[model samples]
Target: MLLLALLEAAGIAKLGASIGAGIAAIGAGLGIGRIGSSAMEAIARQPESTGDIRTNMIIAAGFVEGVALFAVIVCLLCLFL
Candidate 1:
């Protein structure tokens, strides 16, 4: 019985981590995708604005990437803890 309880607890912990990682990816994907598409459109419409558009896009992408990275770290900690 004790072994079964231990196994169940481990399974729950793993499941929670997996879910956290998956949820984090969703926000990252949406944010990056939006920035990419908008940047492309901006460049297409005004080629001269490419430089500015790209700069802003990079900054926004970095922020999104950071959040995703944080989520990944949290997931890792949850699993190991």
Candidate 2:
């Protein structure tokens, strides 16, 4: 009975960690997708200004990727810590 109780508690802890990781990914996906779509639309509307648009898009994409990486790192820390 004691062993079963311990296992149940561990299972609950793991579930929380799993949920945290999943939420982080979802948030990152939404943010990155929004940045990408906006960049694409801007480029489509102004082909002549493609150079400037592409530069900004690359910068924005990098920011998005950085944030996502940070979230993932935090998630991993939470799981391990």
Q: Pick the candidate with the highest TM-score.
A: 1
Model 2 misplaced regions, further than 4 Å: 1-11
Per-residue error for 66 in candidate 2, Å, reads 1.2
Tens digit of lDDT per residue, candidate 2, span 2-54? Answer: 76457556776456666777877787778878877887898899889888987
**What does the lDDT read for residue 72 in candidate 1?**
87
Off by over 4 Å in 1: 1-10
lDDT for predicted candidate 2 compared with the true structure = 0.75
How well is each residue in 3-39 modelled by candidate 1, as lDDT tens digits?
A: 6458557698778788899889998999899999999
Q: What is the C-alpha RMSD of each candidate to the true structure, in Å?
A: 4.3, 5.0
Error of 2 at 31 (Å): 1.8
Q: Which 10-residue span in candidate 1 carries the lowest summed lDDT?
A: 1-10
Give every collision pair in model 2. none
lDDT winner: 1
Report the error of model 1 at residue 37, Å. 0.2
Clashing pairs in 1: none
